[model samples]
Target: MYLFRLAMASLANRRFTALLTVFAIALSVCLLLAVERVRTEARASFASTISGTDLIVGARSGSINLLLYSVFRIGNATNNIRWDSFEHFAHSPRVKWAIPMSLGDSHRGYRVMGTSAAYFEHYHYGRGQALQLAQGRAFASDPFEVVLGAEVADALKYRLGEQIVLAHGVATVSLVKHDDKPFTVVGILQRTGTPVDRTLHISLGGMQALHIDWKAGMPAQGAGRISAEQTRSMDLTPQAITAFMLGLNSKIATFTVQREINEFRGEPLLAILPGVALQELWSLMGTAEKALFVVSLFVVITGLIGMLTAILTSLNERRREMAILRSVGARPWHIASLLVLEAFALAFSGVLLGTLLLYAGIAGAQGYVQANYGLYLPLALPSRYEWTLLGAILAAALLMGCVPAWRAYRQSLADGLSIRL
Candidate 1:
């Protein structure tokens, strides 16, 4: 205990060098913990992107593919499910709500989603949080009105009542545009740190109206023009939708509904539980995650090695000081314990500072992170695994302490006091 105080006092005497060693360890610990925290939060945010839905029904395809396109907006669907099929299940007595989704349109590179007002009412993200309007109201019966996601609205500088045209296809640089069918920004959604924040929402009718004049993906020449007023009267019912999310009144019926959707005679379809599909998706990415973690672990190891080197090098210079303690009745084991205590002090300080640094970085950059990657990294204490890692580092530091401590133990009473040229 006295040796611990003496060791800290000794380090304070060489504060400059001590601080440099601590700095190296601190940065390494910071990076290690940062990677772990981000990785964990990313997994959580990714899985939570769309929850409170028992199953995501889409045209028959791999669950991973369906999740990628429907939830992540990463790719296109193989085929669309008929609106009639969607409606049939949507009206099931067991169903609490359903939000039909139609894709294949883009606005300024952001994906445009066609859905009903039920989306604003039933869709949930990040633990069942309902979609909230940040600026204006949700799109109502108006076929030409649009709702912008927070990121989409902010990135494009769109305001309520701003008019924007959607490209014919999902391509960001589509050559064909719906110049005649511009949509008004009726609402802007609160940031959810999900794909929704980058999407453009519109009524399913709006999607149908946008292409009412096009035939086979091209504007039909000599075709009867359908103005917005005319579109109001025309059938806006969606022919086919990319996917639909369903919330059941009773979760016990999840399997029953999913089975019914899969066995439907109307069309080939697949029903995937979000939690199960997410786990399957993670299996594909698990290797890469482990690789990143291993790399961070090595960085922490290298930093500890550097701290070890600094302590060992400083031991020789402190031999004379050690001899002074010997003269003051300090035992050989006391010198050893003193050396060990200093290493422990440095490691503990570094770990403490590193943990703080991680939270500070997350607090400062989480907004940018969410806006860019749509992943929310919450500010929180070190997780169980992170605490385990810190414990390992301290254990390593204590072990590394023994190396220099042993060398100090070998110093003779007369040898440490005598100087050799």
Candidate 2:
């Protein structure tokens, strides 16, 4: 009890240094926890973005690339799969439903996805949840009609029956605009916290109509422009699509369908399990994740080192105080234990402060994170792995405490009594 009081008095006397040390440790702990949380949640969000689909089929390309463009609205596809090829697999006995997707167009800045009404019926995200309309309904058979994602509607302040023009290419701003064939917003989707929320949905026919006046990817100077009324009577069938997503009738058939698509003679095609492709994509980012983890660990070690420095630096000024204690019957081991206790107290306090800061920050930014990044960070207790990390931190603090404790133990009676300052 006496040693504890003396240690508390010593820390209070140098409260400024003690406070700074605690703050350093707290910030380090916050960063370590934040990095791990974001890493875990980001990967989970990536995986859950498009679920319930057995495989994603695209032109022969890297699995990660296909997953990126098809699901995440990332880079352009190297080549498009034929519409007929999509039909062939979509009708197979082994397949349940295949959702065709055509890309390479944009409205304002959001991506315009050419798909079918079947998309609303068949496409699922975040565990078999079907797409639902928050207002209005899905697009009809008309090629001039379009549906808006929840974010598209909210961000652009669009309403049902509003007319919007699409750009020729996928750029945020395009020189060539399809102004003649404006689409009526027929539907607004409910928020899914996925890529679906960021996409503008249109029929495959609409996609073909947008490019019908073009030949070899450039608009013909004198090409005939078709009116919206004329587009209905014209052949609106699509020639090729960027990709397609398939849901299989049986999980056992996944490998068989994958093999069939890889060896497809109709066109150079590729198919991959969505889960496997997601893993492949994440593997590309594994280095960044590891780097963050290593940096966080270093920050923690640095914080502990700061605490050790503060305690060791204070020991010299306290040599006379220590000699007085020795004269009053205090042992060197008691002095050593006092330093250890002070170190543990600082560490424990820092840990608590850091944990509270982490949770508070997470709670405050949860909505913004989901709105911008489509990542849902759960406000749950520390995970088992986190507990292990905390335990390791505690153990490291104790080990560091031994440093100043040993220094104090080595001090002699004469050394403390002869201190000048």
Candidate 3:
């Protein structure tokens, strides 16, 4: 207890240096914890985005691209599966449910997806929770009715019963608009923290209605434009669909169904397991993740280096004090313990401050992230991995203090009964 008091007094003598050391470690700890949290949550968000769907089927292409466009909404699809393919699969005995999608349109920079009602029925996220309507009701069998994702509604400030115009061919600035026919927002989905939240959804008939007056990417000038009622009179059969989400009738037959979809002779198609494809995507992103982790480690090393320099540089002024303590019957071990104890206190204080900062960050900015990017940044309890990382940091802090402790031990032994200036 006396040695501990002596350590406290020694730290108090140089409070400015102690404070600087604490601040340095605190900043490093903040960066380290923040980066790890992002890594864990980002991967969780990615994996949970398309859960409960057994497989994603699309036109022949790499599994990565298909998953990217269909699930992540990161890129465009290479090609589209024929509408007949969707029909066949929907009726296939091996399939339980299938939802078709049509893309290549956007509303103010957000992707516009044309899909059937099966999307809301079969699509699930975050541990198989079905999509729920936050407000209003689903489309009541109307051709011009639409549903908005939580992000789209929030960003565009749209409400139920508001009218919206669809743009042509995914161009935000396109002059071509479906001005003749508008969609009424029938429903708004709750936040899912997935790509679903970033999309504007409508029925395939709505997509067909918009393109009725245009052909081969050109407007039919003489045709003028038709109203939504006229669109109902015309056949709304879709030739191609961007992709389809599939659910299997039997979980055990997933491989068989995937093989059948891949080998379907009607047209070249691809089937990908959502889990397997997500792992593949993570594998592709592992390099970036590793780089982030390495950068955090360097930041920690830099902080430790700053602390080591401050302690060693101040040793000259501390030598006289060390000699005085030795003259008062203080053993070398007591002097060494004082140094170690001071280092531990600095490190402990820094870790505490860093953890508080992290909590404050999550509390403040989590809502913005969830609303805008479909990522839920929850303030979770410390995970086992986090505890382990903290333990490692504590150990590193102790080891770092050993340098100054050793120096103090040597100084006390050499200056017995003599004051060193």
What's the lDDT for residue 300 in model 1? 86
> Which has the higher TM-score value, candidate number 2 or candidate number 3?
3
Among residues 3 or more apart in sequence or in different chains, the pairs in candidate 2 whose N, CA or C atoms overlap within 3 Å are none
- Order of candidates by lDDT, top first? 1, 2, 3
Off by over 4 Å in 2: 1-8, 159-162, 219-223, 327-333, 359-372
The clash count of every prediction, one per candidate, is: 0, 0, 0
- Flag the better candidate by lDDT, 1 or 3: 1
What is candidate 2's lDDT per residue for 301-345, written digit by digit as tens?
999999999998888888898888888998999989999989988
**In candidate 1, residue 355 scores what lDDT?**
83
Question: Which parts of model 3 are misplaced by more than 4 Å?
Answer: 1-9, 169-177, 219-223, 413-421
State model 2's lDDT.
0.88
178-224, model 3: which lDDT tens digit per residue? Answer: 77788999999998888899888888888877887886787667557
lDDT of each: 0.88, 0.88, 0.84
**What is the TM-score (0 to 1) of candidate 1?**
0.87
Clashing residue pairs in candidate 3, if any?
A: none
What is candidate 3's local distance difference test score? Answer: 0.84
- List model 1 lDDT by residue over 128-182, tens digit each: 8989999989888889999999988887888998899989787769898888888
